[model samples]
Target: MNLKTFLRGIHLREEKELAEKSAIRRVLPEGEMVYPLSQHIGAPAKPVVAPGDRVLMGQQIAEPDGMISAGICSSVSGTVKKIEPRMTVMGETRDAIVIENDGQYTPAEGFGAKRDYKSLSPDEIRTIIRDAGIVGMGGAGFPTAVKLTPKNPESIDTVIINGAECEPYLTSDHRLMLERPDELIEGLRVMLRLFPKAKGVIGIENNKPDAIKLLSEKLSGDPQISVQPLKTKYPQGGERMLIHAVTGRDIHSKMLPADAGCIVQNVATAIAVYQAVCCSTPLITRVMTVSGDGVNTPCNLEVYVGVSHQKVLEAAGGLNCEPEKLISGGPMMGTALYTLDVPVQKTSASILAFAHDPVAANPSTPCIHCGRCVSVCPVHLVPQMMQVAADFDDFERFEKLHGMECIECGCCTAACPAHRTLTQSFKYGKASVNRLRREAKAAAAKD
Candidate 1:
């Protein structure tokens, strides 16, 4: 069978076998749920319910504070214990809503009731997604409503479902595709309603033959939807990379997928959309892959949002021992967690515990100027040049080298013989450059 893949991506040990076969099981939150206000990419949600106010499951507790923000819904029936600072998986503390789960998950009126999407207008559908507090569950955490409402929906000719789940050790999306294939399709159909001209395609990596076969069989004889199996490769699920591989399209740093006549949603995100639009169920729970050699049992759990990482690890039969390394998301692109106290948010994909910390154990040495870093970059940027620009504090040189375009997929660092921290350098450079730009913009406004 002919397969599709992007160029210049490194091939690593998939490491998915650890948890891919595990069926999804609901892992209820046993402790107080801590809902971070700034869970998505835009402005943090504003609390609408005060402390001591009683809330039910699926109740809207917070409202969007800005144009690009997302709303927040309570996942359990309880009293608003307090609004306080809480830590997230990224090792940062932000103001959050602390709810005392009363054990009885009482649903709000109209919650979980079935609704026909066919009768609703596009605007109504978009409003439903916004109210459900859905975001890009595959890791980006961008508000799903904002993604659905592009500037020019008419230009959208292809709607892509990102089922690749290409990140190592992350199988939440893989399981979602297998367990809820119909719901996934329904969500895509919901999206196709907004862009009546667009045809939907689900892109799955060939690594998941079971998922590909299942979705294909379910979608048999469908005119507007089909499944396309991609060649197994790291970062194949990256927004730009997947768009390129599936549709032969290219989008740069300044462009959105809509600019390329496409819009993409994650496997779990699509299923959530279906639930929100059809069943009136908010994004309260999602599948998470908790696996690695450090954990005694590897499993895909449907965990409540705002559940602590500590509780999640326990739900997975606890760690085999104290892990040398712990990460949120996947090994290639996930952030290292300093503490297990961090709460899972809408974008929480997986919790990885490793008995061995390879990167830290093998300290970085001076770069040997091997061109492998240059060759393996999916975006075709030169890592060595970007590293020099980053090290020398030359933002202009870094921009010229396309440092901003780096997806930070850890490809260059993985390909380097010298074990350099190339991805981290680019990340730091990108943040610093953005800060400088914001300062410059402020100065111009004063003038």
Candidate 2:
């Protein structure tokens, strides 16, 4: 089989052996659960329950505040203790719902019973997904309902299911693909119902041959879907890269997958869609990987949405030693945590703890113009030039150079011999450009 791949991505040592073969285990919270309202990439959900109100497991505690937002559901049977600001994995405070677990584990009404998905119309399927509060489970956290209801649904020709599991040390998606291939396919079919002309493609990196074989064997004789193996590389699961690799379609920076006659969904998100449509289940629990050199035991766990990271660490058998760094997702793009008190959200995929410092203590030096950053950049952006523009506070030059096109994948930084923070500089440069644009717009409005 000829494995397809995008150009210009670095290959890192895949450290997924610790949890890749481990089956998903359940982790229940022993104390109060924290549900942050602004977990997804839109306006925060509006809290519908108040302090002291009883909420059953899978009950909606908050409703979508806007079209782009998703609803918030309780992952445990409990009473609303309070609704206030709480620290999150992003190292910022946001409004969160504190629920005191009653330990009953009672299921909410209209949940767990499987339904006939074939009888439901496309509109009905989309409605169920929206009400279930499903989002992109691959960590993007964009509302899935909005993604499914594209403006030109009929024009869509392909639906790509991302199963690459490209990030090192993260095997949650890998385990899901191996154990729940049926549900994943069913979810893809469910999405296909929304786009009648679209065929489904399951893209997996060649590193996971088991998943590829299982999905291929199960999908045999199915004309609408096929399994495509991708070359093993970091960020192979990126939306644009995956689309280009699988369909030979290029998604410009300002355009969406819909513009390319495609729609990409994560493997776990596809399963979530299947559950929401067939089981009437809400997006309350997710499978995540807990692994690193610092961990005493590395495993894939199915955890509730509001459980704390500290509890998860304990469930993973605590740390082998004092952790020098804690990250909320995979090391390449995941955020470093300031505190373990932050709760898991719907998009949480992995929690990594490292005993040895992941960063080098050596100070950054001047770029030697080796052009490694330019060579390895998946998006073809010049990280070195962007850094220079940012250092000079030249937002105009940064914007003109298309600094916003940077995906912040850290590949340039990883390939940098000078250990310069190329990705970080581009991030700051983009923020500065956006700020300047907003200021100019405000001034024009005032005029």
Candidate 3:
């Protein structure tokens, strides 16, 4: 089938064979799960249960403060071990609720026995989703309900579901599409009805022909629905990148997809929305891919939130060789794990370990004044110039070059023949600028 190709993306070696052929299994680890209060993007959840208190599975342990926040719940029947600071995906320690599993699996009262979503109004649908604690499962962890209620309704005409698992070694989304295609379509239909004016599109890369074929066949009769197969490329799954690929529109620096008359969601988030709205299931468990050359057995697994990285690695048959580096998500955008004790959260797509010398093969050398970084940048920014400014600690020059606009997709770094750490330098530069802004605000407050 002819696919609707997108502009400007690189194709890295997809080591999906490690987990692509395998199915998602369950990680039945019994112990204390370090459930962080701030799993979503907004304000951190305020705990309702104390250390001595007991909680059943699916019980709302924390309530939402605002519309942009999702509620928090216990994933297992356990006693509150403690509520203390713990390491998170963003690599900072924060307040977390620890629960000790009792092995009973006692679910909270009236967990799934709720009214059907069809009976509810559009506002009611949003309330149900917010109440169930559903967020963007695609790693951004933004509140789902907020996305549904567009601030500027006049701008949006499309709601795109990102099925493009462009990052290598991540097959959780793919497995989800194969296992839960019907549920996905049902969720999409619900979304289309919610956004009456906007058309619904499911964007999948050509690499996953089976998913495209299956989903397209399912959505055939629906006039408002169409399946667009994107060319297999890196960063195609990004909101801005995917939007550009599917709609030929570029989201501005200070705006969201909704600003461009579009709101994109991950395929996993859509299925979760279906379960939350239709099936009345809370966001407790998420599918994750455990793969890399370091692992002996690689496969996708449904892991309860707060389960440690150590447990997941063990489930993947432990490491074959001592890994050079361990990442919380995929290699490209995933954070380097400082400790394996960091529990898996909603945004986690994969746990990657590199045993072989992938980085050692090409060590960083001096930039050869090549224009490759500028040419390959998907957002059309001069990454090389920004890197130079950052290296010299010239904050003025760095900020002037639209350094903050850089998505840090690593395309510039990946394409550099000199193997320069352009992404890392840019990240530091951005952080420094943010810090300066914060300090300025503090000084203004004092004045």
Whole-model Cα lDDT per candidate? 0.93, 0.92, 0.85
TM-score of each candidate structure, all chains considered together: 0.99, 0.99, 0.96
lDDT value, candidate 1, whole model: 0.93
Q: Per-residue lDDT of 161-212 in model 1, one digit per residue for the tens?
A: 9999888888889988888888999999998999999999999999999999
Which residue pairs clash in candidate 2? none
Model 3: per-residue Cα lDDT at residue 337:
82
Candidates 2 and 3, the one with greater TM-score: 2
Per-residue CA lDDT of model 2 for 1-447, tens digit only, reads 889999999999999999998899998787799999999989999999999999999899999998899998899998999999999988889999999998888999988989988999999998899889999998899999999988999999999999998999999999999999999999999999999999999999999999999999999999999999999997899999999999998887799999999999999999999989998899999999999999999999999999999999899999899888899999999989878888999999999999876475656899999999999999988888889999899888888888988888899988999999888888888888888889999999999
lDDT value for model 3:
0.85
TM-score of 2: 0.99
TM-score of 1: 0.99
Candidate 3, residues 406-434: lDDT per residue as tens digits? 88888888889999999999999999999
By lDDT, highest first, what's the ranking? 1, 2, 3
The list of candidate 3 runs beyond 4 A from truth reads none
Q: Any residue pairs clashing in model 1, and if so which?
A: none
C-alpha lDDT of candidate 2 relative to the true structure: 0.92
